[model samples]
Target: MAESLKDKVALVTGAASGIGLATARALIGAGARAVMADRDAAALERLAGELGDAAIPLVTDLLDPDSCAAMIPDALERAGRIDILHCNAGTYIGGDLTETDPAAIDRMLNLNVNAVMKNVHAVIPHMTGRGSGDIIVTCSVAGHFPVPWEPVYSGSKWAITCFVQTMRRQLNKKGIRVGQVSPGPVISALLADWPEENLRKAKESGSLIEPEEISDAILYMLTRPRNVTIRDMIVLPTNFDI
Candidate 1:
């Protein structure tokens, strides 16, 4: 890392597992305190406890609009300040578009798209006020290319990719940096939503990347000089075709 983040406070959504969890660890490793937010209370508390004082467990359910809205203020109150906001929480729905239930699609969009926008919306004022902050979103390779199998999931990420870019351009003058880390199939709880065939094929073809890799990419983005913003980072497994 080119810069040390010793005094920074980072709020990571979906911090209980997967990329969110990994990013929290990476942030702490770089000397930043982590506000771990997730819906899984037990897992979240357990992980935060293991992370010691630097980790603050915040149980948040992005599914609820009220909770989503409160996340930024709550994190700021707890941490005193937020130097980084990792909007990494998301759900996945795979298979043919028709096979997906409308309710399921709604749930996925609520968490993956709506909650993200709400969180970013909530944090902008605080970050812009400070005249500095880093906002990193967990995007996906599917966002860049239309992956046929997970139409809903891909669509949500595509929305996020656009959101991240537009937000970056909008916030640049405010001295707040906004970017996203887009990864190909990562190994995490979110993978549970993948079709069995796709999951198996991913395993057999070594197409799945570990959460830590994405975290590393995120850390790299954050450590860059304030003047240099990595708008998007696309990480893929060595053998992954997509």
Candidate 2:
């Protein structure tokens, strides 16, 4: 069954590190080439090198309109075609809403929400023309329930959850599957904003999950039968509350 995915091309954003990196590796291990896109050119190049020819590096900042707009084309040029698009690049902003900077909110929203939508919109034509494709977004458990400490971040994910569902409805008829993998307190750079004490506590309590877990879920989503679609998969550690 896994061999059925051989030779497929998966374009993964934020592919330099964290969940994106894990997902890229998973795809490559499954015999698919990975188009790894990220702003961290050094990290991306290094990681791509580690993956050899199966990893195609596309260095572009998702926060930059021009760069983000050109990412799909650049990937197509480098990898030929994209059979899967994983919109997993994002930022996090936590704490009091009154204390959060307006500029920071815009940056987070632009990267977390707008960039995801643009990438999806830009790739629609290519997928439709092919009559088959898979799109998965990295949402959060906070998207399903309000997390007081991360109002802005939660709101961004909430927007994404709705977008993925609606997009799935429209894309399903076109032979394209749209879905989201919502994870809780993943061990990633996204937690850099968390208080050190809380982070330590979560780790001790086994509340944090590794990026590979999320990648595994995404791989399962991709390898499902053509008529099967795991629309919204919520993956979390056993100790995670949400």
Candidate 3:
């Protein structure tokens, strides 16, 4: 199974930490080279160094169109080709819509929606030329359900969920697979902005999933037969309530 990914190159955003970082590690372990892109230069550098030659660190700000556009080309220049793109960089805004700052909403939407579209657009041509590729997005359960705690965030995810589904149908004929992994209440920095009491309760109750668990799901999708596509995977903590 490890040999399945041999010689492939994968670009993963938000690779400095959490699910992105775990996915990058798993890809490397599976014998694929990884280009780790993130806004945190120091952390990206450190993790890439730890992962050694198989990992290349690219510091990127996804909020900027230019930066998002450059990610694919930059990875191609370093790794020669990109076989997988993990669009996993995202921010969370947790609060009632009326009380949430407008700027915060923009930040979340731009990164979650705009940046994802830009990155996917940037990689399509390259993947088309190769005649094969995988595009995995990190969507959330909030996308499928109405979560009152994060209405805007949920909206952003819903958009990507639709985008991924539509793109999958459009690109499957081109030998490119587009899919999403929606995890529930992951124990990552993404939840750092959640209400303190809620987060405390989740942790205490052990209802929060870990980053590595999500990474494993990503690997499963990637390692499947080329004839098979895991379109959408919803991963939740075993003890999670919702």
Candidate 4:
């Protein structure tokens, strides 16, 4: 039997745009209340407004350990409980290792790796107490395979993949589901910083996927029977070579 999101409350990070935004919208459509969390305050507010009463915006800076720790509690305060947590807030740094800025690398690791751990730490007790919850992470194909152009970004994602797998084992007995969606070249703000030539090449080749495709995969994971967990989903455009 499939699970239903009706009356459930989901907290989604990076909900201002891309896969996060699309997933939040889909959750709302499935009758779940959404807590949209993002650093972009104005965009978060606007999107939440568009989503109406079903959506609540929570401004969060994933770079701050305190802020990441506070997100789950803040969502709980607003919605009473968080049935789902989508740890999707992340930045991408694309370039050869020699050309990448140290600060940019730090920022990527901070958000993609540290923030994920902090957010998970904050939510675990609550979810375990309830004995039922879902944690979905946005990983990347780059995590599974090496990408010369974005080694640091790939490293961050690889860290997340390992984290998710380990946490799944640890939390399975607690009745909490932990899973990750690894997407290949989604057309989102993450790519906005990519080299113009590479971005243009990818676009021209039709290798970029829409954010909605990733959201659809997330919904599938969420709707599966409680006994059936989709541990990892890899979403990519058919035209995508890597």
Of the candidates shown, which would achieve the greatest lDDT relative to the real structure? Answer: 2
Query: Clashes in candidate 4: how many?
Result: 0
Q: For residues 186-231, what per-residue lDDT tens digits would candidate 3 score against the true structure? A: 9889888998988988989888988999999999999998989999
Clashing pairs in 4: none
Candidate 3 runs further than 4 Å off: 1-3
Question: What ranking of all candidate models by lDDT puts the best one first?
Answer: 2, 4, 3, 1
lDDT score, residue 13, model 4? 95
How well is each residue in 1-242 modelled by candidate 4, as lDDT tens digits? 77899999999999999999999999999999999999999998788778899999999998877787788889999999999999999999988999989998999899999999889889999999999999999999998998888889999999999999999999999999999999999989999888898889889989899999999999999999999999999998898887
The local distance difference test score of each candidate is 0.92, 0.94, 0.93, 0.93
In the predicted model 1, the residue pairs found to clash are: none
Pick the winner on lDDT between candidates 1 and 2. 2
Per-model RMSD to reference: 0.9, 1.0, 1.2, 0.9
lDDT winner between 2 and 3, please give it.
2
Q: Give one digit per residue, the lDDT tens place, for model 1 in 1-242.
A: 37678879999999999999999998998899999999999998789779999999998989987788788889989999999999999989899998889999999899999999989988988998999999999999999999999999999999999999999999999999999999999999888888898899989998889999999999999999888999999999998887
| Candidate 2, run of 10 with poorest lDDT | 1-10
Give the range where candidate 1 is weakest over 10 consecutive residues by summed lDDT.
1-10
After superposing candidate 4 on the true structure, give the runs of residues whose Cα lies further than 4 Å from its correct spot. Answer: none
